[model samples]
Target: MFMRKNQIKCVSKAVLVIIILLFSNELLAQNQRVNSKSNNYFWDNVQFGGGIGLGFGSGYTDISLTPSAIYNFNEYVSLGLGAQYSYVSQKNYYNSHLYGGSLIALFNPIREIQLSAELEELRVNINPNDPSLTSEQFWNTGLFLGAGYRTANVTIGVRYNILQDDNKNVYSDAFMPFVRVYF
Candidate 1:
């Protein structure tokens, strides 16, 4: 009877271990599916796009065409580079090449709508012939708030510049409407 009881206890323990392991594996699989679903909903890869825009503020008016590209490391974070050519009435109407990277964070409360905050640096060079200045190089830092809508592979957005400093003169706040294509 003593040997039989010992054998029964060992079998029971083995069965209990097997059940525990099975349950644990099932839980792990469920967690993996949930994780994958969440990752799929979030944008965690590189994105590229470009658009044209116009800026009018204070005593300055500009028509610009810009081409830009970005690498989004995750759903909430991205870095980008862009160049712009602008014709300004207040200045000598020279074209400026701008290269800057922006760090942006996105908040999406719904499937189609997203809000973002970005900090960027814009480098500008003034026309040498402008009587108001001899030679000027502008390094402007701008803070922007934007909202976007996504449809298929395209995103349409509007942004407001809350801060801008051109080193020589500061201009009034401005707004930009843009579109981006994702691949």
Candidate 2:
């Protein structure tokens, strides 16, 4: 039996969604380790941070906002969740919007080195200005592995998306540089 491209895309998306659901369930179970007696302990171990982006040019505009929170299980390990929203437009071309959520894990082997893994799922909508061109909508998933140099509450690093597909993924490339801060 042979599958068409669209069929394959649909199957792959379904598989990705299933995997994310299963993994998130495991991550949620970690909350059970928290002590119910002291709410302060939970609050004390939490950190909040994320990113904001803006760009504009002669005929283009882009904007993004991401906010996240993490719970430190210990000095060395942390787990978190994040939300994403992005809008992009090119005059006389197309406009796009993306909304997503992510699960992230951070590991610090020493005080200055941080390693991370992040899984993200986004819904993308693209609308073309020309009536002849059809609109498009799809789901995109990315798994990024990264390492960074950390100082105080900031980290600078690069990450590679292992699951990026040039045609279907939102990112223009598999490798992305990042600056992260937490407080």
Candidate 3:
């Protein structure tokens, strides 16, 4: 009788351990399945959009138009390209027609917001007879860093020019505001 009682107690303990292990495994599997489903939904619905804006600064003012498109490769990474045109005027010295293409890489630290960096090569044509010098075609390169916020289909942000160069060193230290539309 004593041996039988000991045997039954041992069997009950073993059964309880097996039941807990099975329950935990099922919970873990369900959690993984839910995460996978969310990932799939996000990736299937990537987006693309662009915008145009006007800005003014201390010695310069510009009217600019930009068109851009983006491909969201994943939740954290996106690739973009844009075309921009601007008419820029600077304090009776130079008036320029600027056009450029930009390549951008974006990292999203959170949903609906992104940190972006871009490289652009712009072709600038100085107006002739502006009392500065002869008209010339020049190339300018710009590096920009900025943060952006998006709500629905509209995006708004400001970017600081980290570096700027012209064929002639006439202008530097520019900042601009940009707006984007995603369709």
Candidate 4:
């Protein structure tokens, strides 16, 4: 069944997260010894931040929440994970829920320039009020490549989803602009 598939995916993702955390714990132990002058160097290089949004218009509404964290491997590279959840509704149309997780990698070629690649997978559920339309549920995937301008803890840029196609996706368009910040 479709629900069974989604459950499997969720379990797989959770296992991956646990494995990554264990590996990171080992790295953290090693990094602390590498920099004696800065006792909290490893923790200092970790940043936490996320995004929240709400949109409402005539007969329509949307809400989203995403929480994420990243660890700077060095000045030039960082890797992170993010979780997303959203709800959308359009009166007389449909109501939908989407939840997902992502892995992101970022590179800084210069102090002001950043490039990134992100892989995301989401489960979408839709319910229609109209009896004629059937409810639907499925999984969607997106791979985005982007570039941006950075200042301090913020980055503003545009990203293109390489996996976007005719199939239903989280993004309606292949290109989207974004703003990211961490502290």
- Model 4 earns a TM-score of 0.78
Candidate 2 lDDT, tens digit per residue, 1-183? Answer: 356888999999999999999999877775655545368788899999999999999999999999999999998999999999999999999999999999999999999999999999999999999999999999999999999999999999999999989878889999999999999
* Candidate 1 per-residue lDDT over residues 123-173, each given as its tens digit: 766565556656567777777888999666676898887874444432454
Flag regions of model 4 displaced more than 4 Å: 1-39
Model 1 per-residue lDDT at 75: 56
Best by TM-score: 2
Model 3 spans > 4 angstroms off: 1-48, 54-62, 89-94, 165-172
Q: lDDT of each prediction vs. the true structure? A: 0.67, 0.95, 0.77, 0.93
Rank candidates, lDDT, best first: 2, 4, 3, 1
- Per-model C-alpha RMSD: 8.3, 22.1, 11.5, 20.3
TM-score of 3: 0.59
Worst 10 residues of 3 by lDDT: 164-173
lDDT of 1: 0.67
Ranking of candidates on TM-score, top first? 2, 4, 3, 1
What TM-score goes with each of the models? 0.52, 0.79, 0.59, 0.78
- lDDT tens digits by residue: candidate 4, 9-38: 999999999999999999998877777747
Task: Return the lDDT, model 1, position 14.
Answer: 100
Deviation of model 1 at 126, angstroms: 0.2
What count of clashes does model 1 give? 0
